[model samples]
Target chain A: MTTAIARTIDAIWKMEAARIIGGLARRVRDVGLAEDLAQDALIAALEQWPAKGIPPNPGAWLAMTARNKAIDRLRRDANLRRKLDELGHELEDSAMPAEIAEGIQDDVLRLIFTACHPLLPHEAQIALTLRIVCGLTTEEIARAQLVPEPTVQQRIVRAKKKLADAGIGFNDIAPEDFDARLGAVLQVIYLIYNEGYSASSGSSYLRLSLCEEALRLARMLVHMAKEEAEIHALLALMELQSSRARARTDATGTPIPLPEQNRNHWDRLQIARGLKSLETSRNLGGPPGVYYLQAAIAACHARAVTPDATDWPQISALYSLLFELTQSPVVRLNHAVAVGMAYGPSSGLQLLAPLQTEAALRDYHPLWAARGELLYRAERHAEARAAFETAAGMTRNAPEKTALLARAAACGQ
Target chain B: MKVIVFVKATADSEAAVPPTAELLTAMGNYNEELVKAGIMLGGEGLKPSSFAKRVHFDGPNRTVIDGPFTETKELVAGFWIWEVRNMEEAVEWVKRCPNPMFTASDIDIRPMYGMEDYKEWDKEGGWLEQEVKLREQIEAKNA
Candidate 1:
């Protein structure tokens, strides 16, 4: 019944849900309750909008309705009469706009940080962020993460309960802890992006929608936190990497190597945006951060017209800077790959040699994969095949396994 | 989604009249804003119905229709392609546009079809495969 109205409201919900939820969470002082109130407002919309026709300003309507529900709930349930009075007076408004109140963008940021609070498990944090900030449905998150819908729903429910039990206020963050907290939020967004980019744990090779969702989240952050260099840089990195999406996978979804990918298929529009963002980040410069460095590397790749034309030395230098900053074994591995491209294959092998015994990368398939590539270039075919086979065996992802095995088979030639 | 926003032909636009310097400057600023916001992909203005041709094909026969067609209301004087989150976002952006013509005019937004739109009919993916190849070929030819 009223399928068309319901569908329009669904689209409207995606656009307004986060703001309405965030705005209410600030007023009600509880993320979970705020979300429930927002959902109630949505149900009200579904029940009434079809017969009454959609409102002139739907976002404002939703906000006004949610505010009423919030006020009623506080009056009916709360023992803190004084707190309710303050909220009641503060909330009693004359007029509202489609966007919301001033500093409401802070509520959006607060909502993100609340969802990404360090207390929750990383998976749960990610699940909650997808639900609250990205406004994705439980089913969509489930499909994107390749988990069952009920599992995602349970994860979100548990995360909310954890936040509430811990007495975490939806808009509360110590100003002193702001930078570290923002870093966590950025890290969570990056992790979601990487999960989609490589799809490490799933049967599928790529979740393109996840990548897009991450871009949307990053873009939103860039808008809210305009002064933050890392937010812009993170957005830039995602944009540059996403530009290759069409060329990165084949018809069957097997990954195509960067050197082998067709440049013509790259999204020039996204590359331009990425470069512009990188420039913005640079202008707001504080020594280059992880995202800025990575975005620089991606920009190098984006600028290259052909494989031979790629500025591998600059990429190697950027990776070296990144490794110096992060000191992460993964970054070191990437540095080795970039160095191999810039110098001879032997230099790569030399750099990669220490990683062999490094406990952190002991069984990482990418290390072996890098070794396989370098060894193949060194005319060490048998070693290359063995390394490829090792990588093929170690990887859990099906398409990566297929690609590695194909490499191993090719080494025989 | 990518939407092509068509600025409809008003009588003023059909006459190919130049805009006042102030309006021109405002439009220029608007375009610059679009570029800075990273929404505008590309755009151009038409030279009205003049210097235009339409090839009408029926069966094996082809009829070439010359320019200066009637019905200015249906004509598009210009357009800009923008990548936006949804039609609502597109509409919001269009609402911010300066009135293109000195007189009343209209604009239209139409979403472009991407490869995914054909997914249902391309069960075996042959059509997708062929489309990709065709795209590459066209690009190469144009290049």
Candidate 2:
């Protein structure tokens, strides 16, 4: 019964942690201290709830308990008397659901911006976001990230310290800073997702869970900022991408590539969700950002009943817009492939010409791979073979190298 | 991992009466929570056992057993398939779910098997390969 109660509290915490911490942070003006207070309240619940049974309004109880702890901490540390008085007047009934709590979403959003602050290391950002936002324990973070527990613990500790030392307050994001801050938040989520998506070495379940966690966080972000097109777009991109995850690779861990992947294995549910989110993004009506463009591209693939049904012209158009916005060599490479499919190999080769000298692409294996594909299509078999050999030499992954070499041999044939 | 959380039937659910508005709202909120947390994959409220049938197979002999079956609690009133981090997480998520039926009820969390669970038997990766192919075929007819 006690274990069961603890798990119940855990589930409630998962539902209410962000709001609780966000509310406390508003009072204490210290995100880290607010979290500490919230955690203390959680500990108190674990000690009491198992015996007392869960309170009728558990989220309220947690918030009230944490607030009292914050007040006590402030009272003990006499230097912060002014803040204590500010908090003193705030005591009241806390039985309401978290969403109905006034300005709670804004508070949570502020907390997210601080937790995913750009100054923190990428791993630290991930740790803090999972802990404070996702309500995950350090052990859970370590497990999901495939790192040692101590490492995750230290990342959380140091990340909070960095926020404190940098004097990052719990203040709402200013209008000017919103875009950059939102970008950081979105990037951290997408990074976590990519980490999960690319991780082929760990327990498959954990890796997939990481992707789900990212999706969860992204969904929360969309809730918090209902007006942001990119947020919905990011969710769409992830949903669309995750839908095909089951068929993206073969038994040997060799990538199936987009066209060759079994369209049937693509998750229709997630595709529907992606398309819905994409529609939402369009309704929000902003200049299509990187995520929006990519999601649009993914949507094209999803709408295709078969590989041949894919509207490469539309995809190439989306990539062109994407390349114009980001000017990323990777996007250019993708655009080349789309152009090749929609137009011809010669058109793709023309787009690749500038990327040939791109300093960033000189060592990039995919550039060579794309070149090899285009050249093979253009009937320059010898050139395609050399390009494939170069790609094969550059790749560090064994399966990828083998695949590239096989392609090279295919060109010879 | 994923789990199928079944809301076991109580006498109240077996009656096939619609839930009270309060219960419906509570469940709606609970479902929204599940979706917001990104754990709810899919779920449905099942019709009572009076409308269900069980096919029993004994040594290639097939028999259809009609409902309503006598085992009241054994029948499922509803179920949810959730993608969760672990059995613990699944249990925790289910713990907060609102009462699925009037009166006392139980929600059983059964962790589904994944490819990794059968890795020991997949000496040559055949199981994993076949699982992917099987998923592909299932989608072929539906997706």
Candidate 3:
């Protein structure tokens, strides 16, 4: 009714909707149905809440409302008989055990798995995740992924139908299947966070919302599978990076280098949360997953009081572990930058020498960006300027281009 | 007031229609806000004009316009329906809503007529009642 009321309701919904829908999907075993029921509940709220006043526990209220709507739909739909037979007679939402919340998380995780399912193209998986699980509309998903909106819509529709047709149960898969699904989940989360950290396109460099969603999803995974050290590590890594969000950009949305950023603006709470999660990974006591290693590296950054105080050696060591685990050219490129800081630019440049020929990374803007940094550090200003120029040319984001161009100018100066 | 918010999509404004991971994240947050507010009533973006076409008729003639239309600004994107108290309320909400693009964008809102607007039509009803009933049935099926 009023601006304040609308804003308050909006804030609560953003925080709670994912978990509520996740929980509902687990019960219904149908992503589309779960979303529909959730929306129905939202509609009921829109009609009722302004007059009744906000509920004391809005999340529980929404969940309860969604459950009721699901039951009502089950009763009223023409296919009720067959649907009940398939879902079992005890499919009422209110009767759902507390364990179903856990089930919902599993569904959310399963939805992630489905979106990231290897059967579909990478673009399709991304588009589907943003659409189904993230509750983003198809157009928004398309805009985020930089594909045409129809392309995104088709991918999502196909993704959902594929999941339904494949008879992919929302609950447990085989160990191998679980691993495959988890890999997809990790990739989707990483993609979302990476996009937020440094936008692939657009005028602004940082997108706090996408980063926050990814971080939240990652954390949900951690809670869903606590013993998985890699999950904890990934969560920690995301949290640590997110801690730097406020310091990532200037007032005009230009990229701000870590060293130049006002560290005070970094979220101390997020840094603390990240470190705690990292501790959880360490306590699990196995070789860290790729995400864990990266989190460890981020933790080093978080712990540092100043740029000079950063633990380059430790970060370099973590990157070494990550390189061994993932073998991604991008990982190696990052390791090279860390090595430049840990030892000397010569060693880093030597490592980069071989990578320059790596086909996978030939067009990667960050590879050239790292090379430029190494050369600049080595005082090969002219070569560094060329590298930065190349990086600036390759990048699509305005802020990243600005950063690279500024670096290139400094190289000649 | 039952307002039909028309969401028109166009790809002509930019060379690339694909959103970066970062922009998706921001847009995701914005959508979450909309959904939470209870203003969102069925919204989605369509594919580019390349996969789309329009059919029209003049007297008994038929015409088709393939997508990638020269005038994208005039194109109709996807839209949402909001049941607010009045048009002024809808305008206030739209004014505060985030611009979907970093460049610039606009949304068009049109009010939908309900049963109350049908008094004169009802008085002259012949096949209109049957048409209205059929429409209701279709809406129920879709819902």
> Using TM-score as the measure, which candidate wins?
2
lDDT of 3 by residue, B95-133 (tens): 555565555677888987633234235544444456645
For model 1, residues A122-172, the per-residue Cα lDDT tens digits are 989999998887777898889888899999999999999998778676544
Q: What is the TM-score of chain B alone in each candidate?
A: 0.81, 0.82, 0.69
Q: List the DockQ of the predictions in order.
A: 0.21, 0.38, 0.01
**Which residue segments of model 2 deviate by more than 4 Å?**
A1-16, A42-65, A82-106, A119-121, A146-151, A201-205, B9-15, B46-75, B115-126, B129-143
**Predicted candidate 1 versus true structure: per-residue lDDT over B16-69, tens digit per residue:** 898899998889998865654445767999997876788999999999999777
How well is each residue in A1-413 modelled by candidate 2, as lDDT tens digits?
A: 76766677787887789889989988887788899999999999998888788887788999999999988988789766665454444433223344333323477777888888889988999889889987988888888788899999888889988887776667635555668888999999998898788874324546666787888888877876778899999999999999987778787566788889877678898899899999999999969998999999999999999888999999999999999999888998899889999999999999998998999888899999999999999999999999999999999989889999999999975
Query: Among these predicted structures, which one has the highest lDDT?
Result: 2
Sort the candidates on lDDT, descending order: 2, 1, 3
Question: Which of candidates 1 and 3 is the stronger one according to TM-score?
Answer: 1
| Candidate 2 reference-contact recovery | 0.46
Q: Each candidate: how many clashes?
A: 0, 0, 15
* Candidate rank order under TM-score: 2, 1, 3
Better of 1 and 2 by DockQ: 2
Error at B38, model 1, angstroms: 9.9
lDDT of 2 by residue, B1-143 (tens): 67899999998788897899998999999898777666777899899899999999999899999999989988889899887766767866776777777688888999887545755467566778798778768867785
- By TM-score, the better pick of 2 and 3 is 2
